[model samples]
Target: MSRLEPLTMPVPQSASPATPAARFHNVEIILPRQESQAAAQMICEVFRAANDLFPGAPYRTHVRDLATQMRSAPDGWKPRTAIFLGGISTRWTLNSGEKASLQRICRQTPRCLFAGSAIFLLPETGLNTRYETAVHANFAAAAKEEDLPCAPAGTLTTVSDRISTAISSFAALRLLTTYLREDRGAFIADAVCDYLGLALGPTADHSRVSLQLRQAAGGDALIVKILELMQRNIEEPLLIRDIASQAGVSPRKLERRFQEKTRTSPLAAYRKLRIEKARQLLLHTSLPLTEIVAATGFGSRSNLTEWFKREYKTSPQAFRKQYYAEREPQRSLA
Candidate 1:
């Protein structure tokens, strides 16, 4: 079993300089009654990642609950885009004031997005009477009963006029990335997706070779399956021979296919995946160095640091510090 050698790979660079935009777009994430806090936080995390990668802080996000109807948005708080997260119960009732507030916000905002069960709000608020909505299968019957215009079966998301709807929270993430790609560029959107360990999806038209090898694996079914196995077994990496056996190919064939498709050996590709996972945990999480090493299958802090420095040109601690140091001022302002 050979180990991955120290290879210096250039970090993904932004296409433009870090200059502030003329004006930041305000985005309001509305939780129409009780919703998943984790879902709302994930949405905000995407925006934050975009802000970190892009030149300027192009978006300012606010999480508001319609359960506490304030009658109107606060002074000087004009949201350009509003997103309604899904998790509310179909039977959960809303009063006139809440419904009115939802309607008012939807009418005022230039763009609106509904995720998961939040599609129900479309008809309830009189916003999507004429447009087809991407309703989750779990809520399809309910949506039909409520007279909501449901899109065709298996539709993940749909956009009509100024409104967009998604069938599930995962689809909502992809929709948000699509919006980001339009607002920013493919570089920024793909970079953020790479950092979050998310697929850039079929809509991405970027030409950069992604650090996540799965993105560049092309149409090789064997390579794709092996890459997925590598991703799933990050905490306890599998040996090349074992992986080959599980993938139903000989070790020699696995190595040949990986090299042909990814231009890297099986062991090297596996190491890269683990290193990338370490990078994500370092930036997006508060886990300590030892925990990160253990989780990424590096076996020791020194090993993790050596490969992390080789891949990212910085030690894990320094990388984490530099990233958050740059983000602290933005947090204070927010």
Candidate 2:
């Protein structure tokens, strides 16, 4: 990975030392009508975690619809930062009114972030014309056709002036962490990254279990694909046969490969992944046990409780309570 340049907010030269900064910074996340709610929820969760860690709730986040915003102009309220998420289809082009509204928003906002196919909007809004934007491989040809200044292939993210662009979900998370580090201190940013299982820099640490699983696979494409499938289907796990079929292998061969490489059965590995996910949600989120059970593919409260206790040697509620109790001092210091 290339070295990431520091992300800094441009300070006004006229500001004196005695000038007080705003207590809270407002962030606006704009989504297209057809876009998934997942991206918007992810952005909001980042800020929500930050607010819990910070004393003053430094970041205030809001979500808005792009179509609605274009139809009705913002009532003289501009956010400190505006983030645009990619839509389901990049085939649609912006009309005159939408383009004008976006241009005005980008001009007024102090910082703007474009993720995935949203980079195409830069040309239409006349923003980031001078910057080399990180374009996703899927959208690179379309971006170039639209006259976007695409960065070199495999470039994850780019920050130029007040604008930042990220090509993929991982890149977007990194970019968001950089922005958080810039706004808050490194401590707060690192804390959020750790909670989200995100790495701050190229050499930063990631989820240990995940990293170990990948390393154990030893670059076997089949095992890697199976692992990815398991991770993606955490909320609704696939049967071992279905998983093997999707990976283009027979169930017996899949089990043999797993035993040879990781020394664990496919069913056991899948159960472990789901339990790990449940543990993370228990620690980081305030969702109820029923919700966590549902989210982790556990069939019922009793079933999840049984498996969770077997793995962790403690009940889920007890674990969550103890974890937060242990972190109380750290929260106080923050």
Candidate 3:
């Protein structure tokens, strides 16, 4: 669902909210692995999700041999590259031919080109995957079906270090491949989740707060925890009194602390975070305005539009258009 070519790919299956197995389906694609250029081209085509990010700089790989080993191996790094999937109908494993083909396309290349488009059904991890090392571009996922959150989908810049984390993101596509001779979908899912956990680190980002703000809170861990909770549940209509009770303080005391540290009331801060989340959804996703309204707890599309106009002086549609128009030149030049 991330991105696909003219070729056929698998589609996601529906499952009841209580059913985990029904949430998955198999997806596969077999590219032309004979010629290096053809193989790289095929890979780029399949990873169109990433290729499209930097339009002028499409993905490329130029490697001549697979027998060459890496210059040096790092400690505690067991380098093995394999694809994982879920809801497969047949057993699969990496046969000699496919493994050799992959080595020729990836391992042999000095800088192998890789892209993947797939979807993964995940449990309630609060965390998802992403490929960017910094925080400029949008973090995109596939469609939102029912209430399931899509896995992070993108391209990897390198084949070492945390390459597994980046590649696991591409598995968000609805397609499944059977290049393996044994059933490894479950194993792949586990590995992907573990790698993603490592990549995302051990803590959730509390809205990218600054050290100055932390100091302003006067080392108030309660205030920091409350702010993080607000960031985590941006869509929920959480009341200040509830937050105050959770912090073991009166609503008035909580408001005083918020004003002292953040120069805003608790509800005001929560609303700001919700609107910010709405802005992100508008920029990164293709969901309808109604869906965005629901996701952000804006009560209605008109309410969302009102707040968006108040903040950005433009409708969501116009904001999206203007944002892209501004970025179009950069993408073209890239």
Error of 1 at 85 (Å): 0.8
lDDT of 3 at 187: 29
lDDT: the better of candidates 1 and 2:
2
Comparison by TM-score, 1 against 3, better one: 1
Measured by lDDT, the strongest candidate is: 2
Per-candidate TM-score against the hidden true structure? 0.55, 0.53, 0.39
TM-score of 1: 0.55
In candidate 2, which residue pairs get closer than 3 Å at backbone N, Cα or C atoms, i.e. clash? none
Residue-level lDDT of model 2, residues 31-95, one tens digit each, is: 66555556677777777766654434356666665555444544666678888877434643566
Query: Between the candidate structures 2 and 3, which one is better when assessed by lDDT?
Result: 2
Q: For residues 132-242, could you state the per-residue lDDT of candidate 1 as single tens digits?
A: 999887887888898888899999999987889888767888888888887876656776786676764544322122333544565468986787677778899999999
Candidate lDDT values, in order: 0.74, 0.75, 0.43
Off by over 4 Å in 3: 1-201, 208-219, 330-334
Ranking by lDDT: 2, 1, 3
Q: What TM-score does candidate 2 reach? A: 0.53
Better of 1 and 3 by lDDT: 1
